[model samples]
Target: MVSEERRVTLREVARVAGVSVSAVSYALRGAANIPAETAARVRAVADKLGYRPNARVGELMAHIRQARPLAKAEPLALVYLEGDRATAKKNGFAQIVEASARLHAAHRGYRLDAFWLSEVEGNARRLAGILTARGISGVLFAPTVGEKRIELDWPWADFAVAVAGMSELSVALPRAGHHHYEAMREVLRRMSAKGARRPAAMIEATTNERAHRGWQAAWLAYGPAGAARRLWLYRAGEKNELAAWLQRLKPDALVTDNANLIHAAQAAGWAEPNERGAVLSWHARSAFGGIDQGYDDIAAHAVDLVVTQLQRNERGLPDPPPMLLFPGRWRECSQTSAGGHAPSLREAMRCAL
Candidate 1:
């Protein structure tokens, strides 16, 4: 009868081949330093002995390689399409997102480089050449303000790309952004809990379009039983119709993206949050209570997503681009009394009257 044998091992193969363990390892991994004849002989020995590589060991080795700090990697491009510096600054969220992405990329042993679309004179081919020359294989498209659509004529098939917001570019790419619809829902819920009978939404048409109409959709969905939900649209440099809408709807609480809505309501002879509740959907300052969009988190995730594409060798627009949304945090900006307790809206209303 044939004798039973255990699995072949690399150590036994090395011993039989009269080579050091390191030599055996290098030879097996096809290191160039090993003599071709020696490598071939060792491989033959391994094959004869049925010395198969251990999957778990391979996985651990891969993990070790990844854990080792890389000296350098190709820089990632943060493409900004805003027309000018002032426009970029005015879109405060874009600045925050770019800063967050830069920090996160550094943590991953990579550099983030900013590329302003305006600098390239709106030439996509020139942008592509610049990126190629810099060896940048990954891109993070920053959120674009206004109604301008980004049309890139670059060789997109060669680079991994992702967008911070859906409105950033016309091309379909993986996106990371705040959960606008859910945030609207959350605001409505909080208002309801505060005994607000009627809640309405007023959004700038451009802002609404940029957010993919999420605010309007959420408001329409949250209409209470037997109540007609109202959504007011505001166009830039257009006549102010919000006052008329307020007079007609008489909504107890109003949710809006524009902070100026408070002034508009006041001009309409209604005290904000005191006579009628007001919630700023996009809160840029601590003085106004609204949803914190968590821009930093969104930007970090966007970097990660783009890096993942680079690692996987994925390029161009994704078929059915995936969207990642982060939830917004609610902030209460109600006025506080000397005792540090928030004054009731009713109390403020009485004071205003």
Candidate 2:
């Protein structure tokens, strides 16, 4: 009769192969020091004994071996909210978030799934059911717009939860995003350092004031003596208003959130970055000079925060600390000055369009 211990141990195999346990381990791992004949013999014994590394044992050992406690493995969800102008801007941000989350999840052994709240139908219960069935215990809420705030059914407290963007969480959820205020301020500062004075900021009429607060604060903190004009491209209208503003403000540099403003400026023939003009992206990316604010970094951090909370068996927000704001790269629009002949933001933006 065969022994009930159908599973085999490395010790048993090593003993049968007449070798030290370390030698067996080295041979099995294909370390160069092991002789070919000896490695073959140990492998044969291991195979005959059905020796397999015990997954649970290995996991426990890994946890024990870590200087920091290992987080429990869990699956997570990223849910998107819906709103018109707000939702329109979500696409680019969503892509960056998803890309970053996917990369982190792949490395960390966590699973990430994206679900559109709008597509989930009328029953929030159904959304809850799907999560329970999938054993997903964590969530990252992307900026969502709906007729009303999403009513979630699952116990968020039983898992980790996080949100993106500048909007305050309805619940006690932790938030992570690029420091829009600091970034904008820095953009203004850099533009000034690069020779801009009396910089102007242009934005969409519907742009979030809170998200823009950093830029505003930065402006207040480091702006020139006279107030810089705030131009709304959406409201600017087709009568060359952008051009009018450009001529009127005569700003040494410009800051804007609207992609259209840049295009409009280019259309009005203000695209070139000479000694007289510059445009910087604010919490947005363009072919123009400005900050990335590390969208990818924020995405990665969001994934980690969610996973960490889940591992700790944390559910809903209980005043989670804000993540460190990662600064973005600032490239001068005129790359002709750089040692390598790199394309400027204007050329790149035009190419993207």
Candidate 2 residue runs with Cα over 4 Å from true position: 1-73, 83-92, 144-154, 210-212, 228-240, 266-272, 275-285, 320-323, 335-353
**Scored by CA lDDT, what does every candidate get?**
0.70, 0.61
Task: Tell me the tens digit of each residue's lDDT in model 1 across 1-353.
Answer: 11125656778989999998889889987899999999999989877776755433433444465663221125889987666556766776767887899977754445799888788888877887898888787888887667557666777777778888656565778989878788888888887887778767777888877787777777778755533347767687653676777888777777777656765675787544642344544333533456777777788889888876665455777888888997667766554454665556553333221
How many clashes show up per model?
0, 12
> Could you estimate the TM-score for every candidate?
0.71, 0.66
Quality of model 2 by C-alpha lDDT = 0.61
Model 2 weakest 10-residue run by lDDT: 275-284
18-95 per-residue lDDT for model 2 (tens digits): 999999889976799999999999988876775654433433555565543443445678766543335534667667
C-alpha RMSD between model 2 and the true structure: 10.5
